[model samples]
Target: MNRVYNFAAGPATLPLPVLQTMQAELLDFKGTGTSVMEMSHRGAVYTEVITRARESFKRLLNVPDNYKILFMQGGAIGQNAIIPLNLMGGARKTIDSVISGAWAVKTQAEAARYADAAPIIANSCDAAGRFVSFPEFTTWNRSADAAYINICTNETIHGVEWYPSDAEAAVVNASGAFLVADMSSHILSRPLNVANYGVIYGGAQKNIGPAGVTFVIVRDDLLDMQHPLCPAAFNWRNVADNDSMFNTPPTLSIYIAGLVFEWLESMGGVAAMAALNDAKAKLLYDFIDNSKLYRNDVQSKYRSCMNVPFFLNDESLNAAFLEQSAAAGLAALKGHKMVGGMRASIYNAMPIEGVRALVGFMGEFERQNGQAF
Candidate 1:
């Protein structure tokens, strides 16, 4: 029972209760005399599981009735191209993107392959070329004839989060274009207004479940705009029509996600999770801000609550810090190579005690290494 606190970005940490429940039923789920993985996806028992999962997810997120939740494969990376293929055939045939960090850039690049013109509406880079702050809403140069405006709500690598402001909401509302968000890393960590976006999607590995399932919540009206080249499985309209069984959906992963939804509900849903997440993020961010040996690059207003990327003041100490942290029962403290620093991803499954442990370790490490740096 010696479990270390895991902080990997995806395929990260899941709630222990959910994991235990799964372990309890792994061999024979619900008296069916078979594991969930062995059951037929189209069978009555499996159908009940998927239906409950979708319903629980909808209830937790308060998803609008008009939105269809499709469980598809390919994660967010696959959605990058699929989104453009499905939505770019609109009359405008253009995609307006807000470049915040790595994922947004990838999505925009993929969209460009299908869009008539994919333009950068806003970029969150400073004059020094660091992706630290989000560009103001007024500074966004949106296309007059864009099919959809794309934005990554949270950048997992660069550690920036896009919190919707009144002005930003007003701007999007007036644009008459569908708002598309890549909410992969921070999807259910906070409460979201599902009505605000035409499409919201993410990979389940981050905070929901395993890596096999990707969830797409699309508005009904937007489903009919797929390009002629869109694949039957990747097409949102077709997937929705087939109830996300256009291909064999991620059966086992979806089953785990269903348990997570139930766990969230028992913990008071997204609102409660948001409050706890705020506390966890604040604890770590405040510690880093006050420490002389560590520093976080992203601007205060744009900091990601889920993924907090920080660097040691002395580059030479990076390896030592990682080694010591792992020895001390902290795992996956290494940052993405794109942003070479230490990243602590404290997702919903991370309790405040974990963040407190991290902060305590940071303080001790600084105490020993501060004078030298």
Candidate 2:
């Protein structure tokens, strides 16, 4: 059976080519006669898989040699605690956080439990309690001696992204505090200046592969900043030193992530992906802007290309729209309850075909239901 277009947040869809490749190598990986799931992570075969995965990831991101790429088991949520535990060990207990939406709110709240977490400029919800734009950096109440500044580059649930200009990044970097970011939803969808960030992390499900693997790229110097209470396995230094194999790692997930990295490289790397992603997002957003019955409230400048949350003018038609969209092979269009209507998470795995299919369905749905309201 043909697969329906999956737009759920994550563990989101993956490339069909990657899935097919994994299927062909499922039971006997490269003549090793064992599934990636069954192989010893320490074995030479598995070692090659993970090493190549890391190398491909580095190549795609242009990660500096001063940085270490670690494949860990915790999702982004795990890093909520791990970040503070690792970074807040110095004299500065403050971790200044930029709150954009749901994940940003949660990231700051989680950090406060371990350190002196302070909100920098959180305008996550507007007067109408909707997240439409990111707060300007000038308004940030950034601490002078904060350990690091945590920013969720993309708000997964609220369809807002922070695409800072080079000048804006220069201002942020001037703060002297370490720059840490959660790029879970849009990690490899664009090119990133790895040098600007002291730490950048993301869960693999959305763009890379399945759940169970999380990638954290950190500056070499920050690895020594682990809190005394931080678990040895979770410590960046311990995990990085051990090559992300402090214990039984997420071998299967990492292997699949390896396949994803190779797939991305084959498609001319992140720059090509960024251009395609821009086109897809523009198509959907332009349609939404012109629609009579649908609207997206996110500010044009701060809109997320990875996730588009939209609403029907007639609120009651939500269920019908979702039902019809599913029947038309467009699945998981339901929005998060916090800001409900519909959210189509067009992550890196979601092809332009999927977005075109969704736009076609939306147009048909508007025609069918517009006159009644």
Candidate 3:
């Protein structure tokens, strides 16, 4: 089989080993005479899968004892509403969101349905609504009783990342507001201080396993504040109390995520994955920075290690660049339509060699187009 390097943002490339392991167990998992997908979610075998997966995920992220990781079916978009619904009941009706990019903006719009959302245009570049820099935490106009502070830590579309430093954490902590993070693109890529945020949620398509599962890690105290109007299944407290089985969970996706957790543990966990991701990102970003024709517009400090978005100096060459990339086995090099440029999403499963291949292809394309490399 000809395997092209897939640069898709979600439903992205998974580790080959994880896929092979799943394939090996597909038809009859552990002598059960039934595929994992075919098994009862309540049965002992599936229960074991759930328990181990939760433990492995906690270990991978160093989740604190206070955090409850709930595996749900709705994607991150769902949490945009669920977050406000669950957390806004005890506080003022307003929710403050740090608008960074497309996802943050969308999340704020979704939250508006359930609460009064105040958008703080934190840091956005004039061109393409890119989030190249974040507003200084001290400058943010936070409300005293805001339900929570929402941040899209990694914006997949604009390729911006926010790794909150100690000072930033202190600022947020001082505001008397809960810090909620949408970490869809960069989850499991590194270790996160679970104590720093009130909630962290992500769709399990990039760094995790597949598209169906959405992981929500909420601090126990925050879960107890669900609104009376919140749906039973969407209530974090109920979901946590029921152990993520308030409704029929996404069983198959959870099983796949379990396998992925095992795979991450085998790879020496998140620290090792962070180092690998850093190397991959550096190779591509360094190449782009040096190239005369290509440029990555994101601020160096805030640039995402997971998704690298760049543009050809000559916009006319965009089609040629994509065509050549496809011919060279580097597929899906097109940037999101909202941000018209090329984006290479080098997630956990994207090896350094893939980055090297992409860099080499970019160099060749630049040379052919008579742009100095």
Candidate 4:
């Protein structure tokens, strides 16, 4: 069977060239006569892979010299606890979070266990109670001397994102706190200002590589603030001090991630990807906005470029839509259960051709089903 356009939120898709390169190198990586998976993490060959991966990430994001990029194991969920365990140990134990969607709620709930997790800054919903928009910066209610304020830059399930803005950094600075961002689903999809954040973390499954590794970029000052109870492996200071090799790292995933970084460089880096993503998002959103049979409830300004969730006008057609879309070579269009609808996750690896095909299919589905709705 031919490769289908994958719209799943995570472990989503990799660039074809990256996959092909991995296939070519799977048996004997860089003439080592052993697979990357089989090599020791401390070996010179594997060290080069991890170093290149880390350096490429820093270069692509333009990360500052004061921040350490450590490839740790644990999905974003695990960081919910890990973040507080590290940062909340200081005299300032308050963590303020803006409730954007489901993931933000979870991250704050976990932080509550370790710190004085304050009331949410603001909800994404408006007066009508639709999870379609984001709170304005002026509306934020922050705690005094809070250790850090958390925000998920992108909510994968609800298809909401905090669009790039300087207001977030301003708020953090004014509140006497650093910013901790969960950029799991949309980290590498656009250009970023790394200095504005104290820590930026995300899982590798979506835009980076596979499932085993999680990337954390932390400023130098935050490294030593971990609680004594924090495990050596989960401690950012220890992880950085040992150069992300305190324990065996995810060798294969790091290798593949390095290939992806190189691929992104060849494709003109994140700024170029951002342009392509905007075009793809425009194509899909424009179609949905003009369609009578489908609607995306997300507010125009806050809608995520990486994930688009839309509902059919007639709910009864959802099963048929999913079935037919899959049979037509589109996969994982089902929305998260918390929100019942169809979601198309177009991450970095997904091509514009795939988005065009999806728009074509959606148009056909709308045409055939419009009379009923």
Candidate 1 lDDT, tens digit per residue, 1-373? 9999999998999999999999999998999999999999999999999999999999988998999999999999999988888886678798999999888899999988999899999998777666887777678898888788889999999899986665666678687886889999998898888888889998999989989999999999999888899998899988999888988999999999999999999999999999999999999999899888999988898999999999998999999999999999999999999889899999999989999999999999999886787
* Colliding pairs, model 1: none
| Alpha-carbon deviation at 78 in model 1, angstroms | 0.4
- Model 3, span 36-133: residue lDDT tens: 88888888998898888999999999999989999987799998888888877775677888877888888988887777666563646556455676
Give residue 246's error in model 3 in angstroms.
Answer: 1.5
lDDT of 4 by residue, 206-280 (tens): 999989999999999999888889988999988998889999888888889899999999999999999999999
> Could you tell me the TM-score of candidate 3?
0.96
TM-score: the better of candidates 3 and 4: 4
Off by over 4 Å in 4: 126-130
Considering every candidate listed, which one attains the maximal lDDT? 1
TM-score of each: 0.98, 0.97, 0.96, 0.97
lDDT of 1 at 229: 90
| C-alpha local distance difference test of each model | 0.90, 0.89, 0.86, 0.89
lDDT for 10 in candidate 1 is: 89
Any runs in candidate 3 off by more than 4 Å, and if so which? 121-128, 371-373
Which residue pairs show backbone clashes in model 3? none
Judge candidate 2 at residue 354 and give its lDDT. 95
lDDT of 3: 0.86
